[model samples]
Target chain A: MTRKWLRWMPAVAVPAVIAAAALAGSLPASAGDPLPAKTPAEVLALVAQHSAPSLSGTLEQTSRIGLPELPQAGPSSGSGGAASVLELLSGPHTTRVFLDGPSNVRVQVLDRFAERNAVRSGDQVWLYSSKDNTAMHLTLPADAGHTKDFGHYKHRDTGMHGVMPTPEELAGRLIAAADPTTEVAVHPEVNVAGRAAYNLVITPRTEGTLIGSVAVAVDGESGLPLSVELKARGQEEPAFKLAFTSLSLEAPDASLFAFSPPPGATVKEIEVPAHGTGHWGKGHWPKHGTESGVVPDAEDPAPVAPDAVPPDAVEPDAVAPDYRDPNGALARPTVTGTGWESVVEFPASPASAEADAMLSNDPLLQQAAVAVPGGRLFSTAVVNVLFTDDGRVFAGSVPAERLLTAAAAR
Target chain B: MPSREVPDREVPNRALPIREVAGTDGAADVGTAEPPSDRSSSGWPLLASELAVLFRRRRTWAMMLALAAVPVLMAIAVRASSAVPPGRGPAFLDRITQNGLFVGVTAMLVCVPLFLPLTVGVVAGDTIAGEAGLGTLRYLLVAPAGRVRLLLVKYAGAAGFCIVAPLVVALAGAGIGAALFPVGPVTLLSGDVITPEEAVVRLVLVAAYLTVSLLGLSAVGLFLSTLTDVPVGAMAATIVISVVSQVLGELPQLEWLHPWLFSHYWFGFADLLRQPIAWDAFGDNALLQAGYIAVFGALAYGRFVTKDILS
Candidate 1:
């Protein structure tokens, strides 16, 4: 009997596992349906079973910018003193930075790519580069400088605050634009880099956009992105490649952090004293911009009529404001989109006193990072923006003052 | 002579004339007519006998040897090569060789695109035309063999050679590939990786599919061969047709129509390597290839049976 059972076991066991898998795989999927209520430890163990024995080795990948034939090995931009190609590639440049955390913001330029790169702190700013060896001046907006108000890792329940929607959030937005009933699953996981990451997979329940299903990989550790890949509806080919390099978790060195006036460099610091010259502290009007002179919507709140306010008041009185007024002032601005927000640390240093004086002229960042805090030298500010479905910018503002202050405190 | 008992045992000695049979006479009358020279069994038997005649010519043996030897050479070369990635060599070589949807399809791809199909055309091209060149076609026709059967025997020989040639090439390549590469399992597109044994099973199936693809092309060549008097012309024409189809198939702008083209099915064997085996599309490809074979076969038979082989 035992021998017969052993023979039958081989035949029976093979089919049993397959049967189980088939049944399990075909089970109706319910929203947020947990995978059989197994412990997290058990899930990890099951996943580990299938993973191959990984060889531990660091992979170093370098991609050179393929430039057309050059007669010389030096920089050909004509504005620069002769510099190697590597120097040119690594120099001050604006790169698209995507921070995916509580309130996401796409920083068009994180740091200036130039001979001298400068990072702003509240009361001080740091400037370092090959071009400037001497004391250099830092600049900031006069009234609306960097503030640490918006850079914390606000949890899901925290009210949304950001200029632009994150890529993951955008997935649903885009799908919704094409067809409603599209469902998206967002979860946190560890990526290949061993960093905590937020993974979002969007599937359309009804019709889908040109993009059928998309998975966005956001780094939960740094609240920064490692890569982005777009998967088209029926395409087998990869549509695009987006990646980041030279990621640093630690702040840069302090000595190199501060901006200095380069030797023989003429320093001119323009300091515009903070003054409440307009209805608002800054030149920004809810209706009209300073430069473009574009008019805002009729419903947009405008500066109160001078006669409607009491003599002592600097602004409008909301009490008994015309009820039928189409542009009646609202108490606070509406928060329109989803975003990620997280505080990250960077080195805090200041350029020459002249540079700090120069930064004071900027109207939006006058009070940010006035003094470094003990625990963190950083400040925070909210970034707000609206974008089209395809990630094209409609309107946005990244408060450099807030970002710079936050970096200093951290 | 005693006619009563002698006739029961002994046959009539006098010969009958065949002309008298036409006049309602018996075989005795018909037998006397001159022997019908037209009824002689000279056509196919004569051609079959000429199998030795082919051997006498160095080129025939060379052609056969070349066909047989090329596969061996390819097998040896593939085995000798170390350029392939470790563990993937066999599957890759097998893919390049026996797989009809893959290897066979690729052969059609490479051949049809440039000059490979032309070689198939050469054999087909020479079938009737070569015989005409040797003047043996006329001689064979004079014999009792019908024009249809004569064309058929030639077609069979040509197609048989075509099938055998590719089979040898594929098997040799597979053998070399197996020896050189680590053949334990293969990763398929369906994401289900299989062991070497499973891969081998799939490989065989794929090879059979490739054979089907080849059969269609042979039919096409045979049909083309019947159209021209010059063997070279027929071979070239067939080759040109293959080339044209391949070129036409590559026009991505005409994607919908490409699937209907016969050459479109050339890549069907590649489907075998796909895990979970996408049989629906592969099956459709096979059916399409079968249709081509049938259509071409019918056309060849129709033309050979009815048309004159005067040239």
Candidate 2:
């Protein structure tokens, strides 16, 4: 029996030892290697270098925008409302983004069972949905120049046009917002998607800012950002995280840069109204006559009897200076806080009273919003919007009190 | 010495001549007997015969009936429910009220994860092992149906089940759905609406896609069936593996393993509802199922051919 057992010993022992060694070898050796430390400025410079002119990768974004649960819009509710905006910002979304130079970019957002692709190549941009087999082609204005700085163009275009912000565009905006007032530091090196990265932490120096700090992990070699995390003030955890779960610096296949509506898809062509001399274009204010257009300017306020106003109600314009044009061209929004805590204030129109009333009546909106002293405040995890009785709308990343102060200040 | 004495005792007149003739003619007899069996049994006839035997089983009809009942029950439940809030459930569940065909889609979605796979497992797992368990495998082999050809026939029978199972549910759901609810233009998940004719075409496509998706599981079951003589054990093992794959697919940390899991793209049919019909995931599913078929089909063939038919 002993001899028989010995005969099989080598067979068993050899494989066992080999497997043990293989398991040991697979363990990460990150502990032994000390990362080289660098200053914030150096890291920022590397990040600048990393933002390549053309690149593509898979992006994963998770927004814990602490949005209060809103009532579902019943079939009666019309399309393109504030509820949709909240829906866009309050979920975990995954997308594949490809950028070729500044003029050609494609973003494909994946749904559970569907896909929405926005492809911008040259002067034409196509929005395609696989679910409905519908395609919308938007021809950019001739003057929307083909600049190499696509990030800047995308920000200016998408922000004004109300297009959903792509993760790559959002990352660019966050990085561009960095200024001297931001306290920057380098964190220990970490691995992102199997690649070594250097974390650049940016903390706002100002008070009343809701964001604690923003951390961006830059690929050590490519200088490209691998991930960006935002933590709200007083919170130990990040409220929002956008990261490239997988990235490739390689230029994507050329065919992806083109878009042709597949057969059977309903194709609609959109003519982007030319920009007016005023800073505000058709993109900012609702284009009248357009299908599903924004609520027509409230020049004629909804039939709310003047008696509806209480004697104690404070006039918002009296407290806050009117910064908007009577013709409805909005003054460029003013930014107060820097970096992650920045508050962008757009002077609201008194004409918007009609629009406000319509929104206030929306059961879904009413449920999502909380009554404030002078207005209604809609709060989400990462953003807060204050709609004042005087028709001024103040939105920021800060808390409601911060927005209230901004709204009340002269 | 006893063997020699026995031959000598029987050696009388015929022993020497018979022994000399047997030695010379043995090779010729063997050659003549082999060709007739080889030439007579063609693969198609054998396949037809095997399919007949398989379909004649009461269990096959029972499985088909059970699958058919799923859609009927789903339609009844959805019709009875007061309201299904939009965007609350799987893609088409909310639309069941508007279009009865959506009930079929909802039924498919509900069954694909567990019921469909389990039914497939039962059929596929019984293919080879069940025959062996009943002590019929040896007799079949003796009929000299080529081993590889016999394995292929078994696989084809299981593949046939995979196709028919989904069709049964779809037809039942469509029938019950038409009776219980409204039928009109189908609204796709992409928010695009298509004509009823287009919707029917899509439903057919969905059924076909589902059948292809099930190919992976069928192959896995067939492979497991080749490994064991006990049909129940093979069925249980196949179901367990599918459940394990599904659980692993759900784990975020094991996301890297998702693409390799046979169940990973089972839901890719959802893409077919999109306006342009997103084909990336759909194509990937087809290719992945084909890969699984190739690998496990080969494995089943490799093992079954050399297996001892003790039963």
The estimated TM-scores of all candidates read 0.37, 0.58
Cα-based RMSD of the predictions, in order?
A: 25.1, 12.4
Worst 10 residues of 2 chain A by lDDT: A303-312
Instruction: Give candidate 2's error at residue B129 in angstroms.
Output: 12
- Clash count per candidate: 76, 10
Return the number of clashes found in candidate 1. 76
- The lDDT for every candidate, in the order shown, is 0.37, 0.64
Off by over 4 Å in 1: A1-410, B1-82, B85-116, B178-201
Q: For all candidates, state DockQ relative to the true structure.
A: 0.01, 0.10
Q: State the lDDT of candidate 2 residue by residue for B112-157, as single tens digits.
A: 8888999899988998999888866654544434455667778998
RMSD of 2: 12.4
lDDT of 2 by residue, A247-366 (tens): 667777676766776544567766565751222222332221223223222221211111011111213222121223435545544667544455556566544554466558767657
Q: Give the interface RMSD values of the models in order.
A: 26.1, 11.3
Question: Where is the poorest 10-residue window by lDDT in model 1 chain B?
Answer: B18-27
At residue A294, candidate 1 shows an lDDT of: 17
